[model samples]
Target: MANIIITGTSRGIGFELVKLFAKEGHQVLALSRNVQPVQRLDLSNVHCFSFDLGNPNDFKKVEAFLEQWNVVDVLINNAGSLLNKPFAETTIEEFERVYKVNVFGVAEMIRTVRHKMGKEGHVVTVSSMGGVQGSMKFPGLSAYSSSKGAVITLTELLAEEYKETGPSFNVLALGAVQTEMLEEAFPGYQALVTALEMATYIKDFALTGHKLYNGKLLQVSNSTP
Candidate 1:
């Protein structure tokens, strides 16, 4: 079984992924600001830790926590932030805040875990298609989208960085998935893919050894299978 690390696991897609991985018999290290109690869960492979991705300093703590452990087989950079404000009304602080969690936080985790990732390991970053081709009518997504773009770029850079390491690295550029984050931003936006499905795809993708997914955008839409 693989040892996996997933961020933003208190709720939404992150939580779904944590459960899914555990169900698949993988050891999961879930990190988020709030961790849900799992007394009802019979799974013995799950471990939760509270972490604020916005704090860049937390990377060291994360590394220290796993320093005594074996290699991590997968790292999912799933935590993200969104601020719904028009460009003219958005501030640098707001933008920076989003970037801190979305971009820098992801990079820090990869950096911290790079050495511990075993051969044929995986790194999946959940990016949005809005960030892939840029958004036109989707206003108020400047900060969020730009941050995703940065993740895509980093995914590409890391793909090359780890090319000779023999790991399956990729970035999943997802379409709208039904989650609390969407409701928080766009009260009633419909989604094409569910969080559970997204998590399943990621888990299976990692096992495929399809390195083309690395450094490329895989948009999840209604037509995606």
Candidate 2:
């Protein structure tokens, strides 16, 4: 049983991830902007916390909670924001908001927990396939994609910097998964992959992928890569 920290667990992929991990007997620290949904689940192994990732100040609460656990086996940076708008029409505020949650938020979370990670610790940050240079790009996702691109770079740098520190870092560039976030970004579009399916894969990867993969950017999709 590992101690896992997963963010954005109120719903969607994060929610499913919490369920999967908790059901498997892992101790899960599930963080979300709102904790009501997680609390309603009443899972014995899942502990819920509420905080806004866009605000770094909110992480102090997370730190306090971590003080009690003392050790973390996996940290899944799954919280994210999306803004689908043409670059010409996108405001600076919108761009900043995306970066706040997608880039800076992930950085702060990692900083808060890095020292508490055990020898088998692994850090997984979820990016988007749209963030990849050669992947299919949509015109209106400049801000979102740019922020995700930054996450991939950040993960790579962290892995290299912490190569001998025991905790392995990796990034997962994911394809469109059926979730509220995807539906909001692309109305009426159907995703080939479901959030539950992605969550299952993530659970397995978080449990053992670090043993063989580090500093790697993996692409996950049901479509042809």
Candidate 3:
């Protein structure tokens, strides 16, 4: 089984992903600010701890874990910070907070893990349809959507920069899924996709998608939210 590292595993798609990988007999390092939810699962193969992307100190914890695990087969940047407010109302501090996690934090995570990743490694960054240029843009997401867009470009650039060394990089521009983040950002909005369904797809892609694709941005969505 592959060694997998997943972020934001407290709930939603991230939480489901931890369960899937662990059940498959893979070694999983689940990262989330609220680790209790995953800790309760008690899976021997799954190790989890409190991880906050915005906290610079949290990266040290990952570095320590890598010392024991050594190599990383897959690293999924699933943690995101969402800010929903009118463009005019959004403050710089608030905007920077979202970017701190969605953009900068992702870059740091990749940097920390790339040394341990070989040619077979895969890094999957979860984005949103809203980040895709020409996708339907919604209001009250200036900071959130823009940060996601930055990540898409970052993934592409890194893929080319590290093309020869391996550990292919990709981004998934997902449509609206019934996640807590979605519910909080857009109240009363119903999504046709479920978190578990998306998590399953992400799992499959993370494991083998690198064979067929590298530096690819897949827009996985039937409907825009």
RMSD of each: 2.4, 1.2, 0.6
Provide the lDDT at 214 for model 1: 56
Q: Which ranges in model 1 have alpha carbons more than 4 Å from their true place?
A: 37-42, 134-137, 209-212, 223-225
Q: Per-residue lDDT for 180 in model 2?
A: 94
TM-scores of all models?
0.91, 0.97, 0.99
| Candidate 3 lDDT tens digits, 1-225 | 999999999999999999999999999999999999999999999998898999999999999989997789999999999998999999999999999999999999999999999999999999999999999999999999999999999999999999999889999999989999999998999999999999999999999999999999999999868
**How much lDDT does each candidate structure score?**
0.79, 0.91, 0.95
Q: In candidate 2, what are the lDDT values of residues 1-225, reduced to their tens digit? A: 899999999989999999999888999999999999999999988998788999878999988888878789999999999898889999999999999999999999999999998667999999999888788888889999989999999998989998988699989999989999998888888898899999999999998999999989999976622
Ranking by TM-score: 3, 2, 1
Q: Give the TM-score comparing model 3 with the true structure, all chains together.
A: 0.99
Worst 10 residues of 2 by lDDT: 216-225
> How far does residue 197 in candidate 3 sit from its true spot (Å)?
0.5
Q: After superposition, how far is residue 33 of candidate 3 from its true place, in Å?
A: 0.4
By lDDT, the candidates rank as 3, 2, 1
Using TM-score as the measure, name the better of candidate 1 and candidate 2: 2
Each prediction's number of clashing residue pairs:
0, 0, 0
